[model samples]
Target: MFKPLWVRSLFIAFTALFLAAPLMAEDVNLSERAPSFWKAEGQDNTVWLFGSVHVLTEDHYPLADKVEEAFEQSAYLVVETDVVNVDPQAQQQLMINAGMLRDGQTLEDVLGEARWERARSLAADNGYDLEQMAMLRPWLIALVLSVTELERMGYTAAHGVETYFLERAEREQKSIVELETLQFQISLFSDMDRDTEVAFLMQTLEEIQDLEAQMEMLVAAWESGELDKLEETMLADFADYPEVYERVVTRRNHNWMNDLTRFLDEGQQDYFVAVGALHMVGEEGVINLLREAGYRVERQ
Candidate 1:
């Protein structure tokens, strides 16, 4: 269902945004603007890149005037994936196919004794029951717990950047495009090797405890465009897990580069691209990737 697949997917996107360090002039006056948005100039067409916070408080809008203007000027809206308007049956099938454990294997078997105990303790402390949650892969359980914690805090994907723009796009009858499919996004977690998945799950469990504070920090960083803390969070969080960082952040940017550049180079109309902010961060981020490919990607 959209409930399960996009709940996890939305959490993943928000988590990824925590890793983004925007490329903008340092110490810009927040009163003037924020730097989480950009514009790429190609020979013919233009692409407006807005780094999205996947979850936000309802008062977080109306967005900045520049972002609104960019959307108004564009002919198409592009997002990482369409979590809305999905087939519930197909999404549930994908979840079942990718998230379930095989015969004779258990969560404890995969996580080993100490990690399993840590997982169980954390889940129980957070009001989850491991026995009832058994048989799913560790990564899926991690995401499930993360989504639950977020919901408990009253955040919903209905207030997310993608959803906001998506609803407006629909109302305006503007075309919408997806950079990836729901299945591919799921495989980013599900296709990881066992150890990688366990490590990811463990880190997620440890981090969710301070989620509220971390979330406020995320919003503060977004508004101020000061990224020292987020850069630190990004490195400390993913530097040890190069594979996880690659799959979740860098590699996906590279994959999206193909679609992004095509839109820039050959599209019949201009586009507005809204992606997780983290995919636009770091040296290997999509904004830099576009610049390296010879487009002049400027902060908006």
Candidate 2:
């Protein structure tokens, strides 16, 4: 049997929360982005890799002192995307164009009756109609549902780590670079099959009730700088969605690894690269990849 949508939603929620907690506090004595930063001998630049959560609440405040210090010392700030200057209207247009299915491809046609009804009922509770969302792909629906739930829970992208740092970078007159484009990220969702999309949504919805507990554990692990624990949780949650893992984590990690090396070799300028925390964990994580490439990675 496939997992419920709520369960999958909870996993996504927990994952987002886990990545965001590191940016909430401003304690100078504590380390925030660990196993995320790497130092290279005989190189004039320092590379600070930070894992970020995409949404956050007011309760998650005062980013860790180390993160702030890293930002202050760095000359450039790198993010997954340059959302700071992105046009909202254009973004919405992109999402709608990418998420909605072609004419005649309805959710019912893809999801069938039993699951479709459940999905409809869940959407109704959130002020959306099933029929209206029927043309949207499953991954798109998953994103909409996840964002809606986080918003209801008082988390917003406006308060997220990436946005916060982007804002800071702009104010400090620091140059900002993106590892990927929003369109590229959106394309990842477009490539998912209907079944995987439905399964992802169903699993997310089933985990809604346990989001708080999961968040607590994720935050604790991240704060403790336990990369292995973080990697384990991600691997388990993402096992059902290999495509997502490949698109969002693995492939991107490799791309960034190449970019990091190039940046060090060519510019010799210090860069603060902040990406989703999940990318920095696991065997193929950017940390290990960098280490394998002969760069020294440290937890501080």
Candidate 3:
């Protein structure tokens, strides 16, 4: 279970981080400390790319000066999605609409006997009731359980990096754009293959007890800004779950590359593009794609 924990860590780091959290920040160094920041220069424009952790803690801010500088220099801020203006209640209803099962199917029916019992047992151990999760689709159940585990391990969506910046953008009246939509992000899970979704849920359950240790390593690796270590611990682990990797990371990276290049070529203003750190690393990442397209992308 823990053997593939790093792969799951990357999954959580990339997608779950984008899920909105409460806006919160605490005093921290003002020095340059963003995990990975890059400047992609086009013939007529520039876009600063910063790899963002979706959820973090109060202690992870005040971000590095360079990140702030880039934001100041840019005319627009881009995120995977703009969660800042979404209504929480509307979002909840949207989730309920997408996360429930049809034909009176239950989570147990979806997970089957062994995996259902495994999940129920884990729930009991963590003081949760699987009965409460009965109507959730498997992917939703996985997200619910994983988020609970992450919370137990001292992580909160409210402390995520994206929430922090979105608040700033609103306060400053800076333009904010999205690479995708909230509906599109939600569909990523809602549309997952049944077996792969179950495997993901099972993998998440198996890693519940180890999440703290895994995230500790993950945070450290992220903070160090070492692309190789980040790639190894995050992206490389996904090799075992090829379909999950392709759908969640690879495909999105490719799509975002097109959006990124277009922004460089067509946008009238410099932009600050923030996405999950995972999308900025490895061979298929946006960074490499831009570099291959002949843009001068350098770490800032």
Who wins the TM-score comparison?
A: 3
Scored by lDDT, the top model is 3
**Candidate structures ordered by lDDT, highest first:** 3, 1, 2
Q: What global local distance difference test value does model 1 have? A: 0.72
Q: Rank the candidates by TM-score, best first.
A: 3, 1, 2
Clashes of each: 0, 29, 5
Query: Local distance difference test, per candidate?
Result: 0.72, 0.67, 0.74
RMSD, each candidate, Å?
5.3, 4.0, 3.9
Candidate 1's residue-wise lDDT over 192-246, tens digit each?
A: 7887777667767777777666666656666555545545554455656666666
Cα error, candidate 3, residue 127 (Å): 1.6
TM-score of each: 0.87, 0.85, 0.90
Error of 1 at 288 (Å): 1.1
Ranking 1 against 3 by TM-score, winner = 3
lDDT of 2 at 15: 26
Off by over 4 Å in 2: 1-42, 124-128
Lowest lDDT 10-residue stretch of candidate 2: 10-19
